[model samples]
Target: ETFVSRMNLESHPDQPEWLSHVNASVLKVKLAMAIIGISSIHLLKTFINAGNYDIKVLMWQTIIHVVFLMSALAIALTDRLLSATHAAAKAGH
Candidate 1:
């Protein structure tokens, strides 16, 4: 429900003051984290049923999991950088 409200707030043109307090970068980071979590679950399930899967399938799942992790890391780092830059700019004003 909160996620849906946030999405609606982002799309609305007439945003309230509270909307300004909600950082979009934070939302992006959260979304990335959710993706990583889902990926991890899928990878874990694959590992548990390893005998049922081909070697190539296991390898691809691992590679995909690594990619999801890397993507999440990148999103978090980028959000941190943007937040720092915004803070600096505000301080300079």
Candidate 2:
């Protein structure tokens, strides 16, 4: 609530008319990421418990997981940046 109040008081410099508001799409994406991240952690633990650990396989899995997770995060951030640019343009900034 305090953050929202402060944001309302400080309009975008380039587009004074622009107001910060809750973005449902962004929230949904974040929620999905949290779910997937938690599930991945649980699966990793289960894999370890299975006691058939192969260093080669585990290393590959870890690498692939990190790559995909980073890519997803990059895409999400890029989407946000693009949306902000578009909004500024629309506001005649």
Question: How does each model score on lDDT?
Answer: 0.85, 0.68
Prediction 2 global C-alpha lDDT: 0.68
State the lDDT of candidate 1 residue by residue for 2-69, as single tens digits.
Answer: 64533566667787877666577778877888988998899999999999999999999999889888
* Poorly placed runs, candidate 2 (over 4 Å): 1-35
TM-score of 2: 0.53
The C-alpha stretches of model 1 lying farther than 4 A from their native spots are 1-21
Candidate 2 residue-wise lDDT, 1-93, digit = tens = 344434445544664542355465566567658856875895588577656767776777677667667766776888788899989999995
Worst 10 residues of 1 by lDDT: 1-10
Clashing pairs in 2: none
| All candidates: TM-score | 0.74, 0.53
